[model samples]
Target: MRSAGKPRYASVMTDPADFSQSPPQEAAPLDEFSLIRRYFHHRQGDTVVLGPGDDGALLVPPAGQQLVMTQDTSLVDRHFPADMAPADVGYRCLAVNLSDLAAMGANPLWFLLSLTLPEVDEDWLAEFSRGMFELADQAGISLVGGDITRGPLAVSIQATGSVPPGLALRRDGARVGDQICLGGVTGAGLLGLEQWQAGQRHGPAIGHFRRPRPQWELGMALRGQASACIDISDGVLADLSHILQASGGLGACLDEAALPEDPPVLAGCSADKQRALQLQGGDDYLLLFTLPAAQPVPRGCYCLGQVDAQPGIRLRQRNGAVGALTVAGWQHF
Candidate 1:
C-alpha cells in the first residue's frame, strides 16, 4: 500500500538454495566513490575550475602570478601520536604544508590529499575531513583531487598557491645588518611532545603540537619587505642555520633575552630540556625571516637578532655571555 506523494517499496528475502538462480547483490561495505562523497566532497571554490572527479583537476592560477607547491607527510607515531584525534591529525597534515607556502609568500589556492588507513572507518573519516576542510575553507583553498587506500595510517597533502613573479621570499637573500624576525614564539610544540611522552596529554603544549596555525597572511605581507624567509618546520635555531648556510655562509647572533619563553609549560623541566625545546626542538611551523635594517618589522612579529658576515650561529645569553651552538637543529637522520 502507498500513501499520496509517497512511494512504496517491496522487501525481498531470498533463500540460500534459490541464490543460484538469482542475480548477485553487492556485499562490499563501502566503495571508493561512496566514501569520497560522504567525506571529502564539498562545493567548489573560486580557484577550482573543476573539482575532485575525473582523472585530474583544473585550477585557475591567479593571472600574472607563479604557482607554488609544497607537500608534507604525516605518519602514525612519527608525526603524531597513535591516540591523537583524527581531526587533529587532519588539521596538522595541512597546516605543515601551508607553512611551506607561507615561507615563500604564496596565497593558498588548492590542495590534494592522499590518505591511507588501516580500514574504512566512517566516523574517523568524517572527523578528519571536517578538520581538514574547515581550515581549507578558512584559507579559501579548494579540494581539488586525491586518492584513498588501505594501509598503515598515513596522510600526504600537496598544496599549491600563487605568488607574484620576482616577489617570492627565499632563504638566500639574507644580508649583513638584516634583522632576523619571528612571527611567534617557539618551544610550545616541543613542550607538547614532552607532555605526550610523559603521559600528560592535555595542556597548552599539546594544543600547540596538535593545532599549529600557519602565518600565511603575515608571509604574504612580508613579500616585498623581507629579504630572506623560511618557516620554522624544524627548531628555530636549526632553521635559521639553513638561511645562514644558504646566504653565502653568513651567520647570525640571537638575543636570548628577546626570545619568547613559556615558563609555565616548561616548569619543572631541566635547563637542558628547556634549551633543547627552545632551540633544537622541531615542528613549530612559525615563520622566521630577515628584514632590511631600515624596514619596520610587521606587527605580530618579534625581532630576534641580526644577520652578520660571520659564518656561524651565536646566542647571547640573558646573563650577557655568548654561547657557541654545537647542535645546529633537529635532524631526521
Candidate 2:
C-alpha cells in the first residue's frame, strides 16, 4: 500500500480547503515533515544541545536552578471557536502555559508543542507559526521538540522554565497577615469572550480574550518577596480559595471597595453584573499572589486584602458588612 511518488511522511493529497469546518485554506497536501520544518522548527538557544528533528530534546540545566514544567490543552469549540483565526489559537496555546511558569517565579526557557490538526493548510500553518513564535521571541523561550498528528483540532503546549533553588513561588507558602495582591484588573476576559461569541470583532474585551498577557516579569520580580502565587485563570474567588486552602487552611478578608471597578471594557455593565464578572470570569491570566504587609508593593498592582487564620474567604463591604466569597470560577467539568 505504498504511494511511490510521495515522501515517506507525506499525508494523502488534497487542497487544504477541501476539508470542512471553518478557516482560511491553502493549496498543498498535508505533509508532516514539511509542516514541522516550516512551522515549529527554528533556531534554539545556546543551551539547547539538540532541538527539533531529534526524537527528544537535549537541554542543559542551568546551574543552581530548578526546572519547572507545565502543560495545557485547548480544544476547538471547547476552549475556542472552530472558526477562530489560526493565529489566535496558536498564540493563546503558548500564553496560557507561560502563565504557569509565571506563577512559579520562573523564567522562560523552552517549550514543546503537541499539536493535533484536522489537516495541514499552508496559510493556516503560516499564521499559526507567526503567532506562536511572536510570543516565543518576546518571552525568550524557544521550541524544542514535540509531536504533530492528524485528529480533531487541539493545541497542547508543555512549557519548561527555571528558578533558583528554594525560591520558587508556590501555593502553600501563604500565611496569616500576608497581603493579598492582584497583578492587574480582572473581568475583561469574560467580557471579551462574550463579545467574540456574539460576533463583535473589535474591542478591548475581544482583544483581552484573544491575547492575555501573562504576568511573567512581575512574577519573576516577586520572587523572595511574595508568600504565595497563582495565576487567575479561574475567577478571583476560585483562584484565591486555592491560595487560601493550600496555605494550611488559611482564609482572606478582601476589601470589596478596593477592587478596581468597571474597567473601560466593562463600563456599560450594571454594578452587580460587574462584580459578578470580576469574581466569576475565567481566562484572566494575571498573577494573584500574597505579600508581607510591610513589603513595598509593585506599581500598577492592587492590594486586595489580607490573609487570615479564619477558615474561609470573606469580603468587607463599603458599609462595613461582611460576607463570604463562596463561589466557583471555571470548572473544566
Candidate 3:
C-alpha cells in the first residue's frame, strides 16, 4: 500500500527494527515515466518486439497465415473497486482481453497494456506488475509495450494472437439446427460480484469474479468444429444475440431445465432467481459455441439450446409454455 505524499519509488526499510511492524506503509508517489520504468519496462522475455517507451507495441507474428486481435478495458468503480488488490486487478485486466482471443481460437502470443492511475504507489505498482508478469509467463504471452498516464484509476489491455489461416471461429458460421454448447460453469462470476457487494469475505464464487481463467484449450479444440463462437462477457442471452443476428437466425430453444448452476449460486438464491441469473448475468467468460447437431459435444461441455430460424429467442420451461427470452445482461450506459 502507498500512502499520500510518499515517493512512488522510494527505497523500503524492510528491517522490523528500522520500520514499525504495523500495517505496511504506502510508498510515495512517482511521475508517470518513473512508474513505467520501475514496473512496466524491460520484462524478462524475448517475444516483446517493442518494449515500453513508445506510443504502442510491435509484436512478432507467428509463422502463419492469420492473426487475431482484441482489446478490453476495466474502469475503477465500474469494473472493480478502487481499493481492490492491485495484483488481482492487473491479472484480470489482462485475462479478459485474452478471453476474447480464446473465443477466436487464437493462441496466446503478445500483449500491450495502458494504465491510468490517480496516483503512483510504488507498492501497488510492484504487486500489479508481478501479477501481470506471472500470468503472461504462464500463458506464454509477452508484454511488449504500453503507456502510463495520470488520470482516474483505469486499466486497459490489448492482446494480439495467431490462428491458422481461415480457421478462426466466428459469429456468422452458426446454421439452423446447430447445437449450442457451453464450456465451464456459467453465472459464477456474476454471483461472485453479488457476494462481494453483500460484504461477504473471500470465497470460491467471489474468487471467480476476481480472476477468470479462460478456457484456452477448449477454444483451440473448437477451431474447426464450432460454426460460431462467443465468450459470455455480456451474459449468455445478450452475447448469443450477436451470433443469432449475425447468422440471420433466431428462436433458440434454451432448456431452462438444462442450464448448469454453480452450487454457491444455487445456495445463495432461489431456483427461479438462479435460473434468471444464469441466463441474464454477465462476466462468465466461458465459451459459448455452436456446432452441428450431429457432432459430439466435447467432454466438460453441456448442451444448452438448439438454433432455430425463428425471429427471436425462446425459452422452454418445465411447464411446456414457451416465451421470448429476455436479454438482461450488462448495460454500460
Candidate 4:
C-alpha cells in the first residue's frame, strides 16, 4: 500500500463489495427555528452581511463581477445513512454545496439552508450546528436566511458567492487539445461509505465520506488559469464527459496509470478491480479542470490526460490499451 500522503488518483485498488441488506431506522422531525438557531445559524465575521432570518441572503460581490449561485440537497436514505451522525450530515450538506462554488472559483459569501426533519433532537441539532458552523467559519461564509418545513429528513442548502469579472469557471469552456487536470483525491469517500455500511469500524476512509474536505483554496487558485472546471460530485469519468459534451465533439483521454491511489484501497483489492472502482465510484468532490496544453500545469494539479478531437471519453491503460470509459456514477433516474 502506498502512503496516505500520495496523490489519491494514482493509487488504484479494489475491495470486496458489500452493501446494506436492510435500511436503517429513521429519526423524528422537530422544531424548525430552534434547530436552525442551534445548528445552522450564526457567522464568524462581517462578510456575512446578513445572517439567518431574512427573505433572502445579501452578500457583497467582487469589485466588478456578479454573484454565482448553486443549490444542493441531501436526503436521509438516498444521500446519506439514516443513522449517520447529525453533525457529520450537517457538515457534509454544507461542504458539498460549497464545493460547487469552489469549482466556479467563487469566494463564498452567504448561504440559505432549508432543513426538513420528521422530529428534531436537541442534541443532534446542537452537534449538527457545530459541524456546519465549523466548516462555514473556515470558508468565511455566513448563513443568512431559509425555510424550515416538516417532512422526511432532508438537508437542502443554497449557496451564493462572487468572483472576479469574467472568471467563473463553467462547463462549456473546454477546447480540443486542452490538458485535463484533477485536483486532490478521488474514490476515498465512496469507498469509505461502502466500508461503513458493511460493518467496518470507523476509520479514515469512512471519515473521508462523512466529512469531505473541499479544496476551496485550490478552486480559488484555478479561477483564471483553468479554461473549464467541474466538481467531481458524480464521479470522475462521468463528470469529465460533461466538459466533452459541452465543448461540441471534444473528447478526453484519461491516463489510468497516472491516477492517484488510496493506500487502504490498494490494500483491499486486486489492481484490475481497483482501477475499475476508481473509474466508476462517486462522492469525490475534487475538481476536474481543463487548461491550454501549451501552458504549464499548475501546482496541486495532476496531469491526467488531454482533450482530444475524438468526440468521446477514453481511458489509456498502463499497457497502452485504450477503451471506452463508463458514464456510471450516482444517478437520480
Top model by lDDT, which number? Answer: 2
Error of 2 at 136 (Å): 0.6
Count of residue pairs whose backbone atoms collide, per candidate: 0, 1, 9, 20
Ranking by lDDT: 2, 1, 3, 4
* Model 1: residues with Cα > 4 Å off, grouped in runs: 1-28, 261-273
- Candidate 3 lDDT, 179-212, residue by residue in tens: 9888866887788788888887588777888888
| Global lDDT of model 2 | 0.84
Across residues 100-135, which tens digit of lDDT does each residue of candidate 2 receive?
999999999999888776765779889998999988
lDDT preference between candidates 2 and 4, better one: 2
Every model's TM-score: 0.89, 0.91, 0.87, 0.86
Q: Among all windows of ten consecutive residues in candidate 4, which has the lowest summed lDDT?
A: 1-10
Lowest summed lDDT across 10 adjacent residues in model 2 is found at 1-10
Please list the C-alpha lDDT of all candidates, in the order they appear.
Answer: 0.81, 0.84, 0.78, 0.76
lDDT tens readout by residue for model 1, 1-333: 001111111012143223123324554344555677778888777778777655788877788999999998888998889888888888889999999999999999888888877766779889999988877877777788888765788898999999999999999999999999988767878888878888886877788888899989988999899999999878888899989899999998888878666467566767667777877778888899999999998887889989999888889989999977764566665
The candidate scoring highest on TM-score is 2
Ranking by TM-score: 2, 1, 3, 4
Q: C-alpha displacement of 53 in model 4, angstroms?
A: 2.9
Stretches of model 2 off by over 4 angstroms after superposition: 1-30
| CA-only RMSD, every prediction | 7.7, 5.3, 6.6, 12.5
